[model samples]
Each structure stands twice: as structure tokens, then as C-alpha cells.
Target: MDLEILNQEIDDDEAAYRVRVVRRVHYLTISRKPTAVLDIDTLCRPYLLIPKLPPFPDGNWTKMRISQAANGETEHVLSWDPLDGIHSLWHPRQVDVLSLKRTADHKARVKEVQFDGRILLSKVAIFEWWIPRLQRETEFYERISKDHCLGSGSVAPTFLGHIMEQERCVGFLLEKIDGRHPLLDDHPACEAALRKLHCIGWVHGDVNICNFLVHQSTGHVKLIDFEYAEPFEETKAQLELQKLKDEFSQMTER
Candidate 1:
């Protein structure tokens, strides 16, 4: 992946700045996975250089300097005060370094790499805008990983670690469930998994069969895809639970 700086401009007051960057990813492999290699300048600096400007009485701006790399790659610099809506302007996405293994969707991609001599699965975003969604799913997995009741086997796979690039988290690694069989809608384990999630104050927003996997050898069922899973409110949780129950019952009758 190569990143080229097209243009950059800063305001006279040094209160705001914008940078245009063009990124290109040449797949050394035969796969057509979307990948981004960002050249972030300010983050590489040893310290932030704040320019002298009339300070807003209410807040202050965080100034950053982006230095150009010897390889002709330019960095982006931005300055904004949090109280003045910095988040709306400069959204920082977590970046990670991982090789592309497979492509999943328009925004999501999968990578398989050797970790500790074991092949693992990596879920990453193909574009910058998709980073937040992937981060949310990572947070959910991390949270549920600590629950003793759910156990590691009942979840999708073991989380290895996060992939970081330019001081941001872009993706995460997990154990590869290569040979698992898909679950049936009426499978008893599906209900049991949903029950466990609800008991732990979470609701698997999507209860389809594709999200549940059955290990071929062990026969242990694992729930996957927490992108839609969220904290269960009383009324909403019951409603979703009952809906899933009705769907499963109907499947059984059929």
C-alpha cells in the first residue's frame, strides 16, 4: 500500500486544517481485498507544536505538526479544541497492520496470519469509515471474553489481539474456526446460547442460524458476530427473546 499526499491547507488562525491523501493498495497476492495504508504525520512527531494564537476563553486547541517522510510521503496536521467540536471534524480511527487473507463485504475483510506459530483469523475494515463499526465489535468481544459462564468455547473464537497502525486500532485477530458446521434454526444450542447472552445483560440483535457455528469434532456450539449485540433493556430484551423463541418454535414445527 502506498499513500500520497495530494494537498493540505491550514487556517490563518491555526484553528483548523484539512489534508487530502490518496492511498493505493497493490495486492501482491491474487486476492482483491480492500486495504488502506495511511501516512499520518502529526502522530509521528515527538511533541505537539502549538502556534501562538488568541486563546478561546472557554477552551484551548491541541496543535500538531506533521513532518514529511524521506520517502516523499507527507503527513497530515490538525488542530482543534474538544469543546469546539473536534470530534465532528477529526475522527481518529484505530489502525493496525495485518496481511489480507480474504474479503468479506464491501467494508469488512478477513486476514489469516501466523501468530505464535498458529494460523489465526483477522477481521479488518477495507475503508476508513468502517473502522468504528469494527472497533465496536472488538469491544463487545473483549467484554464478553471475561464472562466465566459463557466460557471461551461458547463464543466465536479466541481473540488474539488488536491490529494497530499509525497509533490507531484498525482490526483484531481471532482463533480460526476453519472446519465448523453452520447451525440449524431449530438447533437446541441456538436457544441455549441466546439464553446465556440474555442472562448476562446482552441481546444478540441478530439471531439467525448463520451467526451460530457448531464445531465438527467437539460438537460445541459457538455464537458469532456481535456487531449487533448490545446491552439488553428490560422491555426490548424480552421482546427480542420472545421473537426468537417464536421463530425457533415455528422452525421446529415445520
Candidate 2:
């Protein structure tokens, strides 16, 4: 049996899909792209189909499949594009997040906040569609705060504490830093900042210039946005590293 997402178009608030049954084959490999999108017609073994509830985090990062990159070598397969999708969040920002109100997708500074243990907290993480990213990033920062990370791990903003709702930890508080995105001239700073993370045996998955913050006065660099970051894998890291290199080099070329 074959289950294919016919189209991403919403049909009564849910995506419409199609299932097909075909003849036998030797090996079965699943690609992230649908067959129709792949524009391929191949016979598959007809098998029993059973629908079941999906596990929590069905879309977790653990699920890896063949996909394409932007402005690069990609087939006309309808791959999962994170850059796509209509962001119609019922309640974009979380309720009572802070006096100024912020979302989990960005970084902002509020007045110095003090918790029960007299710990200071300024930066905050709110619940939103970025819940998974926030949780994973917070945990990574926690390791840095406790000096349990590799390399210096000091390239990240300081972790103050967790934001609590009753007894549940819904968000986190991190140290606020005033900085700007790296410009073409600040490419060296970007490389140094990225090298720090690589030295720690992790890759800064998103190698965009916007993710590298250059200090306003001190001119130091820090890395942010760990939504796609993971432990270092030589092959993948090299590709991402080249992109990091290209970001600056390309600007210079232009």
C-alpha cells in the first residue's frame, strides 16, 4: 500500500491525500517528496493498509528523508519547505508573556527581571509554533550555562533562569545582548563565531548572516538560532560550513 499526500491544499482544515495499491517489488524506500510531485510512475507491491494515531512529535527532527536545498540542486519534487506555509497562528504571541509582549521567534530586551533566587532574567522564550525550537535551544543553552558543553560555549547569550507558570516551566530567561547582524565587512567575525561552535563539536545548522550577531561597541560576534543545530557530522557540517563561507565571500564578490 502507498500513502501519498496528494496536495497540501487545505480541505476543511486538513490536508487532502490519496492512497494507492500496487504490485510487488524488491526494496521499498520512502522519500519525503510525493510520487506525483516526483513525476514518477513505478509499480509498488500491494499490501495491507492500517491507519493509526501518530506518535508525539511525528515531525520530530529524528525523521530524516531525502530533501532539497534552496537555489541549488533540487528536483521538482514537492519537498517540505519550511519557508512555505501560511502562518495563521490563532494567538501569535503567548498570553502575558511579558509587559511588552513578545513571541518565541525573536529576541528582545525588557527591564531587568529578578526571580525568587534573586537571579536576573531579561531575555525570554514564549510558547508559539516555535515551541519545539525554543525547548531544544533552551536545553542547549542550559548546558552552556552549567559549563557542561564542549569548546568555550560562551559564544551564546547567558542563561538566567526559567520562566514559570505556577510550577511548570513554560519558557526561559536569558541574558540580553545588544548587537546587529553581520555585514560583508564583518565576515571574519562570523567565521570566528562559527568556528567556536564547530570546535565544541556542534554545527550551527542555519548559516545565515542574520544568525550571527555582531556587538554594537565591542565588535565581538555571537551565534544565535539553534532551531536546526545538532551534533557535528563531518559530511553535513562541511556543506554547511561552505555555505557559511560563501555567505561572506559571495557578498565580497558582488
Candidate 3:
């Protein structure tokens, strides 16, 4: 869909602005100056367009434009601020837009996307709409990357980048690991990885077979889904550690 913001009329007394937006899709151009063209899929319904706006009380609207950067490639720079409420459209350069293929439909609405011709997974959490689970997961990945406690071989999928909405991180990108069939043979390595993470002052609060991925060829185990992970306390960590040990012992005995 091609959306063009023709012009904005602002009323300073009421602090409100009326915006005119023209929507065009399927090779249709709406306005004289169409700032952005969005190719949307019909299956993805109830499309949510979060506008990134500048700070409040600026009282200025920046028109969306595509300018040639030093690299000579055109960059889409869009900024919009409307008065009725706080509505701004801004897309950060660092955020990568993935083609969402599937949705988990859970509270967090975990999504699967194809990135760079490969299946990459993503999870989104709106700043105000949803709880802060996505943000927490992002933080965990960042900390793990910096601390380097978990060995590179056993680490979960690589953290790609964040998905931003309105200048805030609402989602994150992660490497998708295939062949995640559950196997008791991978239990020991998964336990070891969790132990390493705990030693770094964190605990994977939710630990199960599903969160452990076993590489079909190499048998390497990678721990994933750290949304429930939290800072480790000596007492609680010990209890959880023992529980994990018992679980693995039973699996091995079988």
C-alpha cells in the first residue's frame, strides 16, 4: 500500500492537527508525493502501523523523504507528528524488517520470518501494548553476548538485531535453529549449558526439552527461550540446579 501524507493543518489553540493520508495498493499511486510504499500481504490482517515521532511539544512536522545518502543508495527517512494524540512515524536504521511468515498467536505473538533467504525467528512486544517479555529477552541476549560465559558452540541462535516501533524496541531478531527434535541423549549437554549460564549469575527459569535444541549431525546442544530467565539467587539457583540434575538423571536412567 502506498500512503501519502498530503498536508497537515494544525490548530495551535487546541493542539490538534488534521492529517490527510491517501492509501494506494496494487500498483496504484495515491498522492503527488508518496513518501512510503508498503507491500503488505493479505493474510496478515489487522495491520498495525506504528508511527515513530519526535519528542513532544516540538510543534513541528518533518515530511517523509527518500534522500540519497553518501553511499548513493536512497534511504527512506520518515517523520510524522499529529496533534490529536502522540502519533509519530520513525524507522531506525539498525532495525531490520523481516517478512513475517507465521505467528505463534500467544500473548507475546512470537513470529517466524524469512530473513536473507533463511528462516529466522522473531518475537515482538509492544512497549505499551504488551508486557516487557520481549525487552527482557533482548537484554538477556545482550548480556550473554557481552559476558561470553556460554561457549560459542553451545550458545543458542545468534541475536541479530532489534525491531523498533516509534523509536522504541518492540521486537527482536534471532537465528533459527532447525532439527529441534527432542532426544534424551542431548540432556547432559543442555544441563551443562544451563550450569554455565547460572555461573554467570543468571538462571533459565523455564527449562524443558523444547528449549534445548539438538543438532542432528554434531549433537551440539543450544539452550534457547530465555524470556523467563532471571538473575540467580544462591538458594533458588541451588534448588533449580538440583531439579535439573534430577530430571537429567532420570532421562539417562531410562
lDDT of 1 by residue, 69-132 (tens): 4575544444452211101111233223533334332222565666566777766554444566
Per-residue accuracy of model 2 over 1-254 as CA lDDT, tens digit each: 23332112222222222221121111112333322212122212122111321221212121112223454443322222221111222212332223323322343323444444443434333222335665666656655545555232367766554553322344555555678988888877788878777777778778888888888988888887776778778887788778988888877877
lDDT of 2 at 17: 25
Query: Candidate 2 at residue 68, lDDT?
Result: 37
Position 147, candidate 1: lDDT: 60
TM-score of 3: 0.55
Q: Which residue runs of candidate 1 sit more than 4 Å off their true CA positions? A: 1-96, 99-108, 146-151, 178-186, 242-254
Residues 1-254, candidate 3: write the lDDT tens digits: 22322112222221111122332101111121222222222111223221422112222333343334567544544455421211211212235332345433423345677666766677665223343565566678767777764344645677776664334455677776764645666666777767777777788887766677777777777777787888887876778768766777777778
For model 2, the local distance difference test gives 0.48
Candidate 2 Cα errors over 4 Å, as ranges: 1-129, 148-153
Q: Estimate each model's TM-score.
A: 0.54, 0.50, 0.55
Which candidate has the highest lDDT of all?
3
Screening candidate 2 with a backbone cut-off below 3 angstroms (N, C-alpha, C), the clashing residue pairs are 23-44, 23-45
Best by TM-score: 3
Give, for candidate 1, the lowest lDDT window spanning 10 residues. 24-33
